[model samples]
Target: MLRNFVILFPAFVSLFWALLFMMRWKRNSRSQNIWAVALLLLSNSMSIAALYWHDYEDYSLIYKLDVLETISTLSFIPVVFLYFERLTGVKKKGQIFRKILLFIPPVLMGGSTVLFYLIVGEERAAEFFKYIVEHDGALSPGFYEYRYVYMCINVYTYSAFLVVQAVLVFIYAGRNILMYRKQLDDFFSNLEGKSMDHHRATLKGLMLFLILVIAIAGSGNLLYVDFGFMVLVFLFLLGGVIFYLCYHVYFISYSADNFIMELKLSDEEALENGYGIMGEDDFGNADTGNMLRAKLLPQLTQVIEEDKVYLQNDLRLDDLARLLHTNRTYISRFIKEEFQCNFSEFINRKRIEYAQELFRESPEMTQEQIAEMSGFTHASSFSRVFKQCAGMTFREFQKGH
Candidate 1:
C-alpha cells in the first residue's frame, strides 16, 4: 500500500492540478494553457518512479516512461520562466521563437533517449538495465558501445542544462519582475493589488523546487537504495509547491494585460512610452521642458495638494494627465524632476501627509478611518506607507503627538 501510494501520490497531484488548469483555461487560456500542459507532462512522468518498487521486465515501457520523465525534467525550468513572464507582464515581440528555443533541450533530450533505445535493441537494452541494477550502477563502458553517449544525455548533459536554465531563468525572471514593479510605480499611485507579490513568492518556491530537484538528481543512488523513498519526499515537496502556485494563479484577479488595457495602450506602445503618453517627438525639448517646469509643475502640485485629488483612492497617472490636459509622459517627467520621485511615491506622499493632518485634527480617528479618508484602499497599506513616509508607525506617531 505504501509503495502504491509512493507511486500514485505525485501522479494524482499533478493530474489534479492539470485538470484544474484545464477547467480554468476558458476563462484564462493564456496563462492556464502552458501550466496545464506542464502539469499533464508531470503526471505522465511520475510513472518513471515506479521502476524502483517493482522490476518490471518491460524494457520498452520503461524506456518510454524514462523519456517522458526526462522531457518533463528538461522542460520544468522553461515552464517556470514562461509562468514568471506571464505574471510579470513581460510581453515582448518575437516571444514565440524565444519560447521555442527554451524548449529545445527537452526536445533534443527526448529524441536522443528514443534513438538510444531503438539503436540498442530490446535485448541489449534489457541486458544493460539488468547489469546496472545488479551491479549497483557500476558502469561497464566496454559492455555497451554507446555507454558514454547514454550517460552524457541521461545524466551529465541534462544536469548541466538544468543548472544553466535555472540560473538564466532566475536572473531574467527577477529582472522582469523588477522592471514590472517599476512600471507599476510609474503608471499607478495605489499599488495595493498590482505589486506582483504573489509572483515573487512563486519565484522563490520555484527556486527551492529546482534546488531540490538538482540535489536529488545528483544523488540518484539514494532513490534506488531507499526504495524510492526520496522520490516520495520529492513528490510531497512538489505537491506543496504546486499547490501554492496553482492556488495563487487560479484566484489571482490581477491581469497585467487588463491593467494596460485600462490605460488604453498597447504593449509595444506602453513599452516605448514607459507607460506614459508622450511620443518620441515630444521628449527632451528645452522649450517643452521649461514650459512644463513653469506651468505644469505648479498645476500638478496645486491639483494634488490644494484640490486634494490624492484623496481619490484609485488615482492614477493617466487620470492626472487627463485632468491637466497634458500627456502622462510630461507629468511623469515633471514629477520626477520637481519631486525627485515617481508618480506612486509622489501621490502616496501626499496621501500620507493628508493622513498626518487628519491624525492631528482628530486624534481619536481609527487607522481604517484615516486610511479610507486619506485615499488608501486598505488600512494595512496605509499603515505601511505611513511608516515609510513618516519614519514611525501610526501608534508611535500618535503617542508622540
Candidate 2:
C-alpha cells in the first residue's frame, strides 16, 4: 500500500496540475501555456516510470519504461523560462528558436534511451533487466558489468544536465527581473493590481525554489539506499514544489494579463492623441535619442509643472510612456541617458522638490499632508526620502521655518 501510494501520489498531483494548466491554457492560449502543458506530460512520464520500475519490477517492460524516464525529470526550467519570457518582453518571432533550444536536452535524452534498448538483444536484455530490478540497482559486477556501469553513469550524467540548466535559467531570469524593477520608478506601478515589493520578492523566491528542487532531486540519486524509500521521499518533495509553482504561476498570469491589457489601451490612446512621441518635430527633422529628449522635455516639464503629475499617489513609467506616446524602455533610457540616474531616483527627486515647494507654501501643513500631495503613498516613506534628499529631517526643516 505504501509503495503504491509513493508512486500514485505524485502521479495524481501531476494529473491535477495538468488539468489546471489545461484550464489556464483554455483561457489564455499563450506560447508559455504550450510548454507548460508539455512539462506536465514529462511529469506524467516520470511518475509512470517510477511506478513501473518499482511496482512492476523485474519485468522487461519495466526496463523500457525506466529508459523513457528520460522524458525530463528536471522539467521546471522550460516552464520557468517561458513564464519569465513574457514578463521580459521576448518577441514572438524569436520564441520559436527559444522553444526549440529548451527541448534539445529532453529530445536527446529520450532518443538515446530508445537507441540503448534497441542495440541489446531480447534474451540478454531480459536477463539484464531482471537482475538490475531484483538487486534494486545495487549490483556489483558480472558478465553484464558494462551494462550496470552504463546505467549508473547515465543517471549521474543526466543529473548534471538538470543542475546546470536550472542555474542558467535562474541567472538569466533573475537579471531580467532586476532590470524590470530598476526601469520602473514605480516598482509596483507596472504590476497591474499587485504590490511592487511583494512581486519582486516572489520572483526571487521562485529562483531560490528552483535551486532547492535541484538539491532535493540530486540528493536522492547520490544517496544509494532502498529504491522504495527514495521514491517516497522524492514524491513528497515533488508534491510540495509543484503546489508552490502552480500558485505563483496563477498570480503571475493574473497580473501580467492585466498589465498587457492596460498597455494596449494606452497604445490606442497614444495613437488617437496624435502626439509625436517617436522623436518627430514640427520641422519634420528626425530627432536622435538626445534630440528626442530635447523635444520631449518641454512637454514633460509642462505636464509635471502645471498639471502636477508627480502629485498623483501612483505614477507609473507605463502611464508616462503612454501619455508621451513612447515606451517604458524609452522612458527609462531618457532618465539614464539624459538625466544620469535610474527611473526611481529621477522620480523621487521630482517628488522631493515638490515636497519642498509645499513646505514653503503652507507652513502649517503637516508632513503627512505634504507627503499625500507629493505622490508618496505613506508619510513614513515620505519623511525618510525628504530627509535623504534635503539633508535634514522634517522636524529640523519645520523648526527652521
Candidate 3:
C-alpha cells in the first residue's frame, strides 16, 4: 500500500496542478498566470521525479532527479508571493530584489548537485543503491552520506520556505477580506427600508470561502506529512464546491437580485438625475426595456474632466470599478448596455476624445505624449483605437483637423 501511494501521489498532484494551469490559461493575462504556470510546471517535474524513483535505483539517476525536484520546489516561494501581489493590486517598484531572493534556493540546489557528483565519484555514483531490504524483510537503507545530507537540506529549506509563503498569503487574504467587508458595509449603509442582509450575506460568504480555502491550503502544508499534497487536493475540491455554491447563491440570492433590480428602479431618478441615459434603438436591445446609463454621470463626467482615468497607463476594469464604487460586472454591463460597446471601446472613445481635444488645443504636445497621456499603456493600442474611432490616424488627425 505504501509503495502504491509513493507512486500514485505525484501523479495525482500533477493532475490537479494541470487543471489549475488550464484555468489560468483561459483567464486574462495577469501576474497570477505566471504563478499558475510556474507551479504547474513544478508539479509536473515532481511527478517525473516520482516516476524515476519508482523505476530506477541507479545513484546517478537518483541524484539528477533530486536536483530537478529541488530546483522546482525552491521556486514555489517567490512565485507564490508574486501571485499574491498581483491579485492584491499592489505594485512595488523594487520588485527585482524579491526576484533575487527567489534565486537563492535554486542556486543552493545546483551547488549541492555539483558537490554530490564530486564526493560520490562517477562509478560509485552510478551503482550505489540508496535503499536495501533487511534480512527480516524490514526496512534498511544505504545512501551516499553527503547526498543524504543534501536531500535533508533541500527538504527542510523548502518546508521552511513554504511556511513563510503560506503565512504571507494568509495575512494578505485576511487584509483583503477586511477591506471587502468594509466596502460592503459602506455600500449597504446607504440603502433605505429593507435590509441588504442577503446581498451582504452572499458577498461575505464568497469572500469568507475564498479566505478559508487559502487558510486551509496554507495550514495544511504545515500539518500534512507529504508537503500537503493530499491537503491541496482537498483544497481544490473544496474550492470547486464553494465556487458552484457561490454561483447559485449569487444569481438566486434576493440581495443580488435586488441589486440588479435597483438598476431599473425609479426610471425618473435614473434618467433625469444623469444616473441613466436613454439610448436609441440603434444600440441593439434584445428586450424592449430601454438601456440606462450609470446615474453617477456627473461623477463620471468629473473623471473625464480631470482626464485621470485615461491618463494612467495600465488601466483595468477593476481599477475603474474601484473608482466607481461598483463591481466589475456592473461597469462592464454599463459599458456594454448603455454605450453599446466593450471596455476597450469605452476607454478608447474617452481617450480619442481627449486626444482630439489635445491635438486641437496643444499643438506643442507630441503625438507620442498625447497617446501616453490619453491612458494607453502601449502606443500601438492607442494608435489602433484612435484610427478606428476617428476615421484617421493620430498624425492625420493632428495634421488635418
Q: Model 2: per-residue lDDT, tens digit, 4-122? A: 76666655666776777777676653634744664576575657555544546446766576556665554556666776766555344666776677767677666766666667655
Model 3 scores what on Cα lDDT? Answer: 0.52
Score residue 354 of candidate 2 by CA lDDT: 87
- lDDT tens digits by residue: candidate 3, 1-401: 55546444544554565465466465523543554555465565546545442444465566566567556655654565555444333435666776676667667765776576567676654544243211211112445455446445544555555455545545554454344333332233112222234334434543554454345334522221333356456435544544442333223322322433443453434344453333344234544333224354555667756746756655555456556654554556666666787665666687788788887888888877887777765577678778889898888876786
Model 1 residue pairs with clashes: none
Strongest candidate by lDDT? 1
lDDT order, best first, reads 1, 2, 3
TM-score pick, better of 2 and 3: 2
Q: TM-score for all predictions? A: 0.88, 0.72, 0.41
Give the per-residue lDDT of model 1 (tens digit) for 198-225.
7677667667766766775676543344
**1 against 3, candidate with superior TM-score:** 1
In angstroms, the error of model 1 at 384 is 2.1
